[model samples]
Structure formats: structure tokens, C-alpha cells
Target: MRKLKKCLLVFISSLAIVLISYGVLFYFNFFQEFVTVKDNKVQWNNLPDDTFKSCYAPKLSFSSMPVTEISQTSINLLGNPVNNIKVLEKAQRYYIPLKSICTVLGFSLVKNNSEFILTKDNMNYILSNTDCIINGQSYSLRGNLIFYENKEYISISDIEYIFNLVADFDMNNKVISLLTPLSNSNKSENELTDGKVALIRLEDFSAESVLLSESGQMKFKIIGNYLNSQGIKYHIAWVPRYKSPSNNIDNDLLSNISIENVGFINTLDYLINHGGQVGLHGYSHQAGNNTSISGIELSHKYNSSEEATRSVLENAIDTASALNIPCTFFESPHYKATSKQKEVIKEYFQYLYEPNSILTFHKIQRENNNLFIPTPLGYVDNLDVSSIEKGLAHPTPGELASLFYHPYKELNFINFSKENFGVKVDYSSSSPLQQIVTSINRYNYRTIHVSDLKN
Candidate 1:
């Protein structure tokens, strides 16, 4: 018994010494925090041992497109910009401050020692270091409590389960969206896809551009093959570039272009037969009798009133019917249409995929009134192709994966500056197919036609 008591005393003394030593080391900054972030490698180093600790980081990367940081991308807190709300990345996980979440989500955090309470709609949320206690029950979580720079942060994963919100992390675009329950199920009877996708690619098919030479035919074949390879039942918006040309027939050298009406119809027939959903872009894609915006045919063409827009649209429909082509939907030339024109269009057409916002037009509204499906991915305006991924900045579901390319790129083409769309571009390599595939995979788009996205 005496020997056993002596052993216990020694063990207790040793444990006390170890504890004191640790406290001293911690007090003197001996266990300093060193964080190292490298490509696909994130480490946390501490002093005394000086050993780097590896974290469980899942491989999250985007292919073919550049990886933008979260800070660089805009995060929507409840579909509005909340400057106070911020996200922090550490240990390969995202953390949001408790205050920011409360402020943005319209809740108050009741603070307690080692725990915080949130009461909203009569239910109480008790958040601790490891569990989110609701009422009297505790739910387990990983990295639920984080302290950085003396401020408390909760894992983004916990926000939805605790706050009745949805957290969408766009891996490709690196944007985060914390949305209300309404933002997730914001679908009318006509708003197409359940969530996964509904694909629509605008062909910029203009009456100004429907030429049927060997090059034109070959380019169409290429687009068809690309779509087939992607297994995308692609729907194309047919822009009727049907302006009466006076002296613009400088295609003597280019066999890809001809003023012959027969070849153009033949090409249209080919598109129709090959799974093309016909839609009028405009009756004429030239802003006739207007000097303010020259090429915006639908915006200022024939007239600004609804009747003229209706007349031009009806002309296109009549032309489609006369040619035995299906005139199902309408898209604006350059997504340029006034509210009055859109009203006229929605009256006649079953659906119209219009731009939420374009480069030149910033004031365009993107409300999903069910008639105007917001065109998310606008025109693929650059040669790098991946530049179009900017549309994923606000990654929402059921949006029209609307993208268009000028077939003129197949020939010697024009390039635009990164900033200005109106300025002409001289040279840029064409990689439209690569960008399209990247975007499709990144967003998990299920291709469909405008008419197909019905109740």
C-alpha cells in the first residue's frame, strides 16, 4: 500500500509538471501558428514540435477555366449584397461569422459562454463548439465553432440546417450564395427544369447571316457534331438577320456567303431536320431608321411601339409558317428589347429567353415573370471562351444556359477587347466548343428547347 501511494504521488507530480510546462510554452508563444497555403496543399504549423499538420482537403478544382478566389467573386446573402457579411477560408473549409449570418438572415444571436442561442419563429437554436442544439436536442457538426482574429465564425455547412436557408457553393465560379427557402423553390408552373438543368444555345442565326455556301454548311456541321459529342439535345435561337441589303454584297471572295435565297433556305432546312427548334431572333436585325443604336433591330427596328414590334414578329412567324418551319419562341437580337416589345413578344410567342444583363445594357431587369426566362450565360463574346464563365457569378438553378456564337468566327473573324464590346477585335483563336463543354459540365446543364420548358 505504501509503494502504491508513492507511485501515485510521482504520477500526479509528473502530470502537474507537464501541464505547467505546456502552459509556459503557450504563454511564451512557443506554439506559434504558421499557416501555409500552396497549390492543392494547405498546412498549419506550430512551434516547439515545428511539424506541419495535414488537413482533410477534398480535391475541389475547376477544369479548363481559371479558379477565382471567393473574395474576388460576389456572394449573395439573401439575394442582396450585404457588405458586412464575409466568408473566410481556413483548413480548406468556409467559415462565416455568427454576427454576419444573423444580420443577413434576419436573426439575433443570443450569446452565452461557449454557446450562442438564436430564436426565430419561436424555435431556439443553441450553437456550441460541436453541436447545434435546437430546442433541447443537439446535432453534431464538424468545425462548427471557429475563432479567427478574436471573432467567432460558424461553418457555412451549419447555416442551412440551423437557419432554414440554402447554401450554394459554385465550385467552378467559386461564388457562394446563401439563399432563403423561397430562392431555392422559386419556380412558376412554366419555369422549366426541376433544378438540374435546361440547356439553350443561341445560334445568332440572323437573316443578315443565313448564308449557305460550303463554309457556312461546314461550320453548321461542326456545331452539330460538337453538340452531338456533348450529348446535348441543343436548342438554338434563330436570329433572323433579314435586313434588306442595298450594297453589302461584298462576298465575291467568300464562298461561305451568298445572296442566293435557295441556298439559305436549304441551310435552314438542314438545321430544322437536324433537331433544331426554330425561334425568331428578329424580323430584321438592323435598327432601321435609328442612329442611336444601329444594330439593335428589335429595340428600335420598324418602331419603338408595341404594334411595330408585333408586326415584325408576326412577319417572322408568317415567314416560318410559309416555309413549313416551326416558329415556337422568340429571342431579341443582341437581347435588345424594350419592356413594351417584350410584352408584345410574350403575347405571341410561347417563351422568350432574354438577357438578364448584357455588356452594353446594364439596366436590364432579370425578374423571372415566367415569360422571360433569364438568359444566364450571355454571348460567348471572346476567343478564350472561358471568359463566358463570368455569368456563373450568381449560380442559381433553372436559369437558361443561354449562350450564342457568331458563325463568322469560323472564317477570319473579329475580336473584342476584354472590357469594351463595341470596339472591334482583330485576332483571337476560336475555342467555342471547349468553353461550351466546360460550362455545361460545370453547371450540369440538361439541354432543352424554349418550347420544351413548359408545365
Candidate 2:
């Protein structure tokens, strides 16, 4: 009996040691950092896959565009936006290549003698060199079917009518704006949320760029105070380190792996405190340069495949875990991640900031079962003035004018001064961030931080 008692005590001691070890590892994030640092990365399945699950605004897609602009909620398209549009001239009217629109816009076309028949989304129309028939109805047009460059050209204006598109031609600017209406239900949802959720993202808040300097912190403080003065909540993305995985740990991301200086910790605390909330901006935001991971984009650093993409994310998550940083959402540096990589990131993050989204009028785009919200105002670089103007006039009620600003800047929002941050904007009046702020306020867009979306 005494021998059995001794054996039981030994087992109890072993169990206690194991439990204590796990606790220590968790507190220090030792296992996440050390193991991953040693190339033993954590798997996405090991982490809890929890994110915000509520529905978002309307989504749009396109083939390409001449220039990027602010995201707008409008008659959204479905496919990549194409930059080059082919058009042919006819009797006093311009005819666009039928094949171009057919392929890009997903229309079905059938050729029968001088008459042409086309169908899309369950409707059919017939056109000839002189007349047009829609489903059976006849309509006269100033333009007609013309053949150019071995391809058929038709007055896109007529097709636009059939497609239920309203074109606003700015003769002064020579700009063509296509408008579409949302369903009553979708419009209701959009009106309730437009511009309500204002996201002031400080891109690359780590050692990779300039956030560590006094100037950078000053810029951060300026924006935070501006938001606070405006009564707005916001989000900040943090990087664990700013170099390759093999590089020695530095900055907020990998600080737990090593105790950082008081000044550094103070800066980090200031950023965490004054900033509305925190998120993951990728660890070692270096792309295509790290020997450990080899790609130009941070998410693609591991390689060009999905499996390699996931492992890179594993590196970020595990490192963040070690540091006790709650990475509620994710954004790629320079918006340089692949769709496959985004899927892998989706498995880890709740929401994603997608600037390089394959869509037009960059609104909240839902792809791969994940809500990819676009930063239409540029990454604190090239602000889309046209996109912003369109959103101001969007037929939908809510306008998510998600604006991105880096501390380092050649400004886009016109006449941006310090005092204007919190003031309500005049929707009819034109201004940079102020217009957005006013729109948010007027639309009842409850200014919210990204953390608000985290479940």
C-alpha cells in the first residue's frame, strides 16, 4: 500500500509540472515564438477560427480600370474592371466592340446574317444594321450595328438601356459615370450603415516603415486626436517585427520574445492607448527579400502556392500569440497578397482590408466567404477623388468611404487642416476627409473601430 501511495504521488508531481510548464509557455508566448523561430510554425487548424459574422454592404467586381478611385456603393459590377475599352465609329455615333462587352460583361451573343442576337441574365435582344428588336419590341436608334476590325460594333448606349444602366456624361470633364439602383432591401441595409463605420487605418505601424520615429508617433497622435475630437473610433495594424523571420526580433511584434526598452514599450503603449484599437499588419512585413520566405508580397513570402501562403500566416499568428497581441483582423502591406493567400489569411483573421480587390467602386466585397472591405481612399498615397465624389452621390443610403492614410503623405483630401477632423462635412460641399466625416454623421454611420466587428 505504501509503494502504491508513493507511485501515485510521483504521478501527481509529473502532472503538476506539465501544467505549470504549459502556463509559463502561454504567458511568455514562448512556444509560439521559439518554436516558430526554429521553423516549427503553428497550423491554422490549431488556432480558433472566430471572426465577425454580420453581413456587410453591397459588393462590386470589374475587369480593370484606367485609374483606381474611392470605393462606392452603386450598381456594382461582377468581374475584374478592364482598363482598355475598344470602340468603333459609326454614322455620327460611337459603337463599342460587341465582343469586348460580351466577354467582360458576360453576355451571350449569336450571329445570324445582317441581324445579331444577344442574351444576358435571362433576356434576349436582336439588332441589325438599321433596326433593333428587344425580346420582340422594336426601337429606333441614331446608331446601328457596324463591323470594325473584323469584330462587330454596336451602339453601347442602346445596350446600356437594355442593361438598365444610366450614364451621366460630364461634358466638361469628359467622364462617363454609370449608375445603377440597389434592391429595396439592399438599399435599406446600405442606408443604415453607409459611412457609419469609418476606418482610419495607419498602414504599416511597425519597424518596416516610419511608425517608430518621433515624427511617426507624432503623426499617429495627430490622427488619434483628430478622431477623438471628431468622436470617431478607429483601428491600428501592428507588425511583430520588420524583417525576415530569420532576422533578430525587433519592435512590438516580437518584443515578448525579448524584453524591450522602456521607451519602446512606452511608444507601443501610446500607440495601443491613443489609437482606437489594434490589428495584425503581418510579421516581418518584408516581401520577396527574406531568404526564409521568398516572395515579393508579405503573404506570398513563403512561396507562390496556398500551402506556402498559409505557413507564412502561421508565422505571423504564432509570433503574435507569443507577444500576447490580439490580431483581430488582417491587412496586407501594399495590398500585395494573392487571392489564395487571402483565403489562408481568412482562415486566421476575422476581417480583411483589401485594397487590390478585383472590383469596381471599391465597397465591401465578399469573396471566398470572407468580407474583404476595400480602402478606396488609397493607402495614404493615391487618393481616389472621383471614387469619393461618386460615393457622395451613390443612390444607396449608406456610403462606406473607407479612407486609408499613412503618416508619411503627399495629401489627397483637399485643404486638410487640423481643426476639421471632428466637424461634420457638408455633403454638397467638396473636401477631403471632412466630406467623409460629414457623410458618416449625416447618414447615421456610427463611427466604429474595426474591433467592433470582432465577435
Candidate 3:
């Protein structure tokens, strides 16, 4: 009986050791799953995939009528006349030879088996029949491909959509003008002759009730004071009026930049005296039942007409001028403005503090009499450091590394060390804004104001 009891005790001890060993191994694997050390860099594992999602979808119906070759049309590529390419009209849609357009754009076109591949820089477009694959993503073409004289032809609309170029058709003059937002040649003499340039824009400063609060004022002061101390120039996108859609406030609430609001206007004056320049963001920064700061002020849904857009710009400019605030630039709220609205805005302001289009690079480019200075580095939402780094890495020589930041998010900027899944996450005390400025400096980009850019 004693011998049997000894054996049972030994067996139980061994079982307990095995269970503890298994638990330790499982815990280690779980910890490693979340935190990984790669190439001397610590990164969080199992994060969401950061692949680019295509906003474009295939058109529902494609035109398949008989083709009518238009021989008398004049082709203009980036304001330069092209003499070799002829336009084709099918079902009232204008099409141009793919190879000729590619040649002018400096993109390579190669036929691979049954598919035609078009490539330029990092963009790859594969064309097979009515199907199109851009950058490894499949989409449907709006019109059927035509083969003329052993060359493939695509519609002008497709060219604009795929290549991020603008196409203007003149029916009377038989002219089709193709324009890109950025041009390597014919650069403006007043453009940034310095290596690369960086501009910082502060967004969503308004007279809203929330922004007028003590907390809001403190946040703005912090950002303004920091930038001034660094000797960095920045632009304040100020909304002159605040209208709340939720409260059903139809009347406009003025920003009250006068001496009556001593505290707020004083802060503004201080910022201006330091290194801040004001830009007219929008008159109210909202349309109809939309709230300020969150709604688009000028878009197809509201204030889209040329007359209405002109009225808004005039009102905004007049208001700023009356306040003695020098606003030489205009930025559409949420960067949402129609083509007609942009044209009117260009007439009102010397510079546009936004991109010419969604696909255009963030560079200082001129159109007619106006200059567009886009924020290519984007904004610091939730302090996305990786995205800002990616933007800084992508721009070629002579491009702008501009970005914006919301002063209200200052409180969320804090350093902390927390353990998740048994791995320590040490967040740096440096804010994304500071990191961006540091990166820009490291890249040897000279910071400049939008007013300094010449058209």
C-alpha cells in the first residue's frame, strides 16, 4: 500500500508540471503574435492591411454603336499641339489612340499576349477588351476598345479617369485639350526654385460655440505658440461664420474678431504677429441643414451654380477685408468644391490652398493666373505617423511636403508606455506634427508660406 501511494503522488506531480509547461508555451506564443521585432524595429502585428482601395467602379452600360472617325480634330497635350493622333467618335463619345497619348505622356505601352499593358512610374494599367486592371485591381471600362490601323483606342473620359488628366473638348474649334496638374517642363519662374518646400496649414478655426470654449482656446494657443517658437510659418484656415444645423440655426454667427471678444481676437493677433497667415476657409463652412466644420460648403449638392459660388466668395472676401484680416488665399471647406466653384474661387483669390484634384501630386503648380499649393502629406488624424512618413518618402525632387493639423487634437497627444499581450508599447513624447517637421528638415525641404509661391 505504501509503494502504490508513492507512485500516485509522483504521477500527480508530473501531471502538474506538464500543465504548467503547456500554459507557459501558450502564453509566449500569444505575446509574440501581437508584438514583433523585425530589423531592429518594433511593430505591432496583426494590424489591418493597408492596401489601396480603388474608389472607382465599372460603368454599368457601355456604348456599342458604329464608330465614326473624326479626322479634322486638333489634339492638344498639356497646351502643346499634337499633329499625329486622330480622334474617333462612337455613340457621341470621343476616343483617342492609346499609343499616341502614351507617347506624349511618357508612359510605356507594351503588348503582352492578349493584353496591352501601360506603365509610368509606379502606375500599371492592363487593358484586355472591355476589362481594365489598374495597379493589380480589376475594373470595367466605360466603352469598348477599338482597333484602328493596328493601334488600340480608348475614350477621352477613360484617359482622364485612368491617367488623372483633364480633358476639355471644344466642339466649335474641334480642339481637345489635355492638361495635367503637374508638369515637369514649362515650370513657372516664380515657382519654388529651392530644392523642396513644406507648408503647414491649421484647419477648422471658427467662431462655433465649441471652439469659443475655454478648452478650445487653450488648444489653439498651444499650437500657435509652439509653431511661433519654432520660427515656423503656418496658415490658419478660419471660418468667418458658424451655423449649427442640429440646433436649426439658420442665421449666420459672425466670428467676432473685433475688440469685443478680446481674448479670442488677441490670440489671433498674436498668432498673426508671430508666423501665422489667415486664409478664408468659407463664409459659413456649411450648406443648408449641414453643420459648420463637418459639412462641405461648396459642392454639387449645394452652392454649385457659378452665380451662387461667386456670391459666397465675394461675401467671404468682403468679410475678411472688413475685419482688416489679410487673406490672400482660399481653401474650400473639406476640400470639396465643384469645377465651376474653383474657377470662381481662382478669380477671387491669388492662391488655392488645396489640391487641383484628388489624384494630383502635392506640389506648387500654376493654372492660368492662380497657384495651387496642396497638402500632400495630408493631416495628422489620430497621429498617424506611418502615413506621414510614407508621404514624405514618395515626393520626387521639387515637390511640396505640405500637411495640416487640427489644434483641437492637442490633448490627445501624450506619451505613454503600456503592456499589451505581455509586450511593452512605448509611445514617443514627440507629436506627429513635430515628427513631420523633423522629417521635412531631414529631407532638406525649405519651409515656405503659400504667399511666397509665385504663379
Candidate 4:
């Protein structure tokens, strides 16, 4: 009986030891699955299989389209999975080549011959460095192969190279990538850092008028104060003077002699004297659609059908020269800009402020690499201030709000009779200007000025 008991004890002890060893080995070999969401799309781990599942199907816009299957492992990234897939498909269908996934995610890419790096989730990755220490791993340069009907094909070697270089990486520190388009590298270093831009601009001052009214000058003063407080750097643009349709309305006959009378030449002098900038605001606040003046005449004040567009731009340059402030930035009158207007402006102004955006007031121009900053001012007819108030209350990141008003609007409403401008009408509910001020304070918003732009 004693011998049998001893044998049983030994057997039990051996079994326990074997079990513990197996557990440790399994733990060491296992990899936990993780999900990544980016660009409004989701991706799940198929690290072992190279397969991805779509977390959500798109709202089919085309009839007879193939049904998309959803995979349980898929993730929802950037809150818009449907749009993300569409962008991916567009890239594939159009054969439009791109470098890294980071670009699609709206982040820049960087690399070094010896080390590969990227920044995502505010965390940085550096591969092929001693810190990563994956030199001994048998990493393979696998392409982004798309498999259809059991056959695979791929040509995106750059992406494959990045994956191979970092496949064995154990992220420990953060780093910024240095790779970028050649044109982007030419931008001032300060402009690229922090990825923030500041603009200073003026409205409606012209070559003919020199006075800074409370409405016009006050706006710039407030902007300067805000920018100084924020410790932000900025560029400035000058308002050029031109003849408006209402320009000929004699001051004596004009009932609303607002500063739309302010000429561009005078506007430039004031901006320069007041530590503001001088940029083109067209020769005149020209309006109208396809019949509008071309770029050359718009800039230089010359009427030429042979070079109507170029003439507008030349006139603008001439006007700028006349004001003693050369300008390459333009803001359309009253946000009334058409699509081709930019192509016209691009001939002279490197930056353009036009009225063609749904969300952003300022946008980086898509083609020219020149800043296509939209002046984010919304049109307020006083009745719709409530909706505007709500949006201001919950402003998005990088949101910019510009308030443009004809000083004459106030003058006309008040009927001060400063000048016999025209027949006047009136209403109550506080002026749109007053509502704008109240909303700004309520939202605790930062006000940017037209004159505070960076040249």
C-alpha cells in the first residue's frame, strides 16, 4: 500500500509540472487581436491570413451593384465607414497612385533610408533602429496583394516596404516622419510646424478713402488684440480700391454713404500705417456671374476682350502698384466668387478667399499648393441668427468665422442721413452687427481679422 501511494504522488507531481509548462508556451506564442479604424473605415486583424472584414456596408447608390458582405472582425474608424470604403474603391478604380495609408488618413509621411517611421494616434513608430532590434527576424517584403478567385496581384511596393521594415517593431517612442512632396518642403519651416496658419485681412477700404470708421477699424483692433493674446503669428492682406456700381452715387445724393466708398489706394495706406497687411481685394468689389470681369482686368483695371481674364489680373497688379502695396492674395467682394474665379486669381494672387466652401472658411487650395483659405464668414439675414448661434456655440476644431457687413447697412438702417444715399427702410430686433457681437461673446470665440493675415 505504501509503495502504491508513493507512485501515485510522483505521477500527480509530474502531471502538474507538464501542465504549467504547456500554459507558458501557449501564452508566449499567442498574439492578441486588435482593430484599427482610420479615414472613416475599419480594419481588423488578418495578420495571420491577410484578410479584412468590412464592418459596415455602404448605402448602395447604384442599382445592380454587388452586395457587400460584412465581417465580424471589422471596425468602424473615423465615424464614417461607408465613405472610407468608397474612397478606397475610388483609388483602386481610377488607378490613382498614392504613397502611404497615412495620406488617406490626412497625415504626412516620412522616412529614412536606415529607419522607417510614422505617427498615428498621437503615437510615433520608428523601425530598423536599435530600439526596435528586429534585425534578426526573417521579415518578408510582401506586396499589398489583392486576391480574387484564388489568384493574387499587387504592385504597391512602397507600402510593402514599410510593412516589412516595421512588422517586428515593438513601439516604444514617438517620432515624426520627414517625407513630403518637394513643393511642401519649400514652405517656411515655421508654417509647417504645429500645422496652424494665421491670416490678417481688411474689408472694404479702398484707394480713394482713408478714414477708419468705428465699424471698420474696430474690427481690426479687436482682431489684433485677440491675436496678440493668443501669441499667434499671422499674415496680412490689403484691401484695394475700385469703382463699384454704387461708387458714382454722389455722396450728396447717397443716403447710405457707408465706407464701400473707401477706395483701395487709401485702404492700403491705412493697413500699412496700422501694422496691418496689404493684399488684393480686386480693383473693385466686382460682382455678377459669368459676365464678371476676367483676372487680368480684375487686377490691372484694363478692359480687354482679347485677354479679358489676364487683363483683370494685370489691372489688379497695377492697382496694387498704384497703392504702393504689391499684393498676391484676393478676397472676392461679399463672398460672391465662382469656381473658375480661383483659376483667374491664381494667375496673380497666390492665396484666394472666395465663397465656395460648405464647412471650412479657409481651405488649402487643392491644386496650386498656394493657400486657398476660405473666409468662414456666414451670411446672416438676422432671421437665421439662431441657427448661426447654435453652430458658433459648438464650433469644430480649426473653425474660423468671418463677419462681413456693409457699414452702410448700419448707416442705412439708422438713417443718420450722413449722406443722401437712397430710400431707407428699417426694422427692429437689434442690428445684425449687434447680434454678431452677442453671439461671439456667448460662444467665447476667437476673432481673426482680415488685416492680420500672413503675407
- The top-ranked prediction according to TM-score is 3
Please give, for residues 1-455, the per-residue lDDT of candidate 1 as tens digits. 99999999999999999989867854443223322223312222311121212211212211111211236544566666657545664323456678877876677888898788887787888888768877787765533466666778775546645664444444345455665532112212222132344344646564334243433533453444344445555555664444434544322211122223323443454444334566777765555442211357666444578667766776566555443345666777667788677766656654666643332121112233333555545555655565456554344322334555555554443222211211122322246654565566565444555544433
How many residue pairs clash in each candidate at the backbone level? 7, 22, 0, 62
Quick one: best lDDT, which candidate? 3
Of 2 and 3, the candidate ahead on TM-score is: 3
lDDT of 4: 0.36
What's the TM for model 4?
0.36
- Candidate 2 minimal-lDDT segment of 10 residues: 60-69
TM-scores, all candidates, are: 0.45, 0.44, 0.51, 0.36
Local accuracy of candidate 2 as per-residue lDDT tens digits, 1-455 = 99999999999999999889867754443222110101112211122224435222212111110111112211212323434555433221234567666776677888898777788876787878756787787755434456555877655345444554322222233233333411110111222333334456655566433343333433344444444455555676666566555565334433321111211222343344333566767665655545211224454444458766665566667654443344667877657787677766776665786643543224554444455666654532253345544554452332245666554442222122112112221122333454555655564545455444422
**Is 1 or 4 the stronger prediction by TM-score?**
1
> lDDT of model 4 at residue 227?
28
Which candidate, 1 or 4, would have the higher lDDT against the true structure? 1
Expressed as tens digits, the lDDT of each residue in 1-455 for candidate 4 is 99999999999999999888866754432323222223322222221121222222222221222222222211111221222221111111100122224555454446577555555665455544222212333222211223233322222222323322101000122111112211111112221122222233434544233223423332332332232333322334333333434436212101222222222122223233223444555554453321122222232233323356545455556544432353545775444444555555555554565534543343322333334556444545543456556656664443444434333243332321111211122323275544654565454443433322332
Task: Identify the runs in model 1 with alpha carbons over 4 angstroms from their true place.
Answer: 1-195, 207-210, 244-259, 289-294, 300-302, 355-370, 390-400, 410-430
Candidate 3: Cα lDDT at 86: 69
lDDT of 1 at 32: 31
Model 4, C-alpha of 307: deviation from truth (Å) = 2.2
Residue 100 of model 3, lDDT score: 85
